[model samples]
Target: MDEFERQSEERGWATAKTLAEALPYIQIYDRETVVIKYGGHAMGETAVAKQFAADVVLLKLMGVNPVVVHGGGPQISAMLDKAGVKSNFVDGLRVTDRDTMAVAEMVLSGAVNKEIAHWISVAGKEADVRGIGLSGKDAGLLTVEKTTRTKRDPDSLIEHEVDLGFVGEPTKVDPKLIAGLIASETDDWVPVIAPIGVADDGQTYNVNADTVAGAVAGSLHAKRMLLLTDVKGVMDRNGDIIRQMTLSEAQALIDDGTASGGMIPKLQTAMAAVRAGVEAVVILDGRRPHAMLVELFTEYGAGTLVKA
Candidate 1:
């Protein structure tokens, strides 16, 4: 029994050692930016939050440039109610007036962005984190137009377009500042971006978290766009994880409706990034402890890997 226990311990240590050995390969892609769209259950849960912070620090220490983009829909909605402002949603997209958009910029760029930066620092990392939180309005970073929806109805038997007012898709992103950040002196500086893009006329548009990250990855031509979601990955009909696939395969799964529900949009964003020449995007479960570090540093990572 003692020998058996000794063997088990040795096996565990061997696995961990092997994972550490793989780190150098990952570092070869270091300073090569990877856009992580952080949100969902991971953001709300305390344990997940702390682990994510540690993960960011670890990534930076490993010489990887991690640009964190966050979502705050739940926070925004709560604030709006507190301010006695009426809110509306169209196809899971919030309808923002000028007032609401102002609140969004303030909250996303000011409060949430800084708070995340602070936490990332407090995680025992002496990072020179320059949290230049901006909406699309600053530096013409993101351009937006209204989101047009195409939905096929079961009863009506027709597909048509519906204009979701103030709901936007990012038409373009100005990557100048992002490039500048990666080129900055500090090896530990990580840019925490809040997902709000601006139009030509200096109007701020509320962009979705995934959309913003995808656009940034596209603009930077990042090696990876790692979306930190709650799920392990895209699951089949029986809810088993799809480990690896090409970008085309992911789209086909969506087309066949095999990947339905909330996973659709997330996978769609990943597909877009790959198509735009981002090397790959992985949808990993952020709820797991050290998932980000494990994914990047080890060959057998958690969740799905969508390659271009």
Candidate 2:
């Protein structure tokens, strides 16, 4: 055979071997629910977004129920800029007022949510699977309460409450809509959720996407909650990724200051999901292609896994 043919043969063999190795891991997650918090570079970059959609479709075809909870921080900011709305952030959460909340809802639920579903539907066409876009407002999927944070005054050395108007925390998550779609036998459906929530007082609130994902995973008793962020994973003091840690170890990281900034919230969300009965939560770098598949189906795995 020619050199080209020989190379092709070798590639085909490698593909077969990889599939063979994935069998057991695939079986482990068959018919199981995995909640993926989709954002960061993966959602921003078009090529990565397409790849992500295809991967979600593959997971569904393999009998893994993948529920995607996506964030649109950058998109919302861009839209706000266009609309001449200035934003303020307090403690990393947007101080969303009435106008800000309207723009947020438009960007997250109206645009970003449908775009993700569109990509997934495009990818799943051949398999007869489709992506259904949803928000917390739809069918009462999520009911939230206003979120408040305390900020320390530099001069007074005291803390004061900061009101993040229209920002919410998930008080109740009703996963029935999601459960029904995934449990349907005749159709394969992947639910793509936007993080906009409604409050008991008939107000709309913008929630943190990671928080929503954790809440959804907990409600569904998901087999895994995959947090796709820009970072590789939770790093130790030595700057190495900690592959696995128990709940106490994770909490210690936060308590001892090993985890800081955005990582702190991610770890806290992971721990909360674990306490809520999620089997495990993995914080993986979404910029790396196929990170979810690697985490789910490979022995080495692709991120820091947190378990109860």
Candidate 3:
């Protein structure tokens, strides 16, 4: 055989070996629910988004129920800018007012949500699977309450309540709509959720997508909650990714200041989901292509795994 044919044969054998190794992991996740919080660079890049869609479709074909909860921070900001609406952030959470909330809803629930579902649908069309776009407003998926934060006054050494207007925290999560879609036998469906919620007073609120993902995963008792962020995973003081940790170890990272900035909240969300009965939470970098599949199906997972 020529060198090219020899190389092709070797590649084919490697592919077969990889699939053989994945069998156990695939069996472990069969008929299980995996809640993926999709955002970061992955959502913004076209090539990465297509890969993500294909991976989700592959998971569904393998009998894994994948529910996607997506965020549109950059998209929302861009739309708000085009609308000439100024935005403010307090403690890394957007201080969403009336106008801001309207733009947020338009961008998140309408544009971003549909785009993700469309990508998934396009990827799964050949297999007869499709993506269903949803939001917290649909079928009572989520009911939220206004979120409040406290800020410390530098001069007075005092703390005061800061109102993040129209920002919400999930007070109730009804996963029945999501459950029904994934449980259907005739048609395969993937639910892509946008994090726009409503309050009891008939007011709309913009919720943090990470918070929404955690709430939904908890409600569904998902087998795994995968938080796709920009970073590799939870890191040690040396900045090396830690492969696995229990709940207490994760808390210690926050307490000792090892986990800082946005990572603090991501860790908190992971802990909360685990406490709420998710089997585990994995924080992996979304920028890396096929990161979710690597984390789920490989022995050496792609990120930090946090468990109760």
Question: Highest lDDT among the candidates is held by which one?
Answer: 2
Per-residue lDDT tens digits for candidate 3, residues 1-308, read 99999999999999999999999999999999999999985587888889999999999999899999999999988888888888889988999888888889998999899989999999999998899999999999999999989999999989999999999999999989999998898999999999999999989999999999999999999999999999999999998999999999999999999999999999999999999889999999998889999999999999999998
lDDT agreement with native, every candidate: 0.80, 0.95, 0.94
User: Which should have the higher TM-score, number 1 or number 3?
Assistant: 3
List model 2 lDDT by residue over 56-167, tens digit each: 9999999899999999999999899998989999978999999999999999999899999999999999998899999999999999999989989999989999999999
Score candidate 3 by lDDT: 0.94
| lDDT score at residue 69, model 2, on the 0-100 scale | 98
lDDT: which is higher, 2 or 3? 2
Write out the backbone clash pairs for model 3. Answer: none
Model 1 lDDT, full chain set: 0.80
Model 1: which ten-residue window has the lowest total lDDT? 124-133
Off by over 4 Å in 1: 1-19, 84-86, 124-132, 150-161
Range of the 10 consecutive residues with the lowest summed lDDT in candidate 2: 39-48
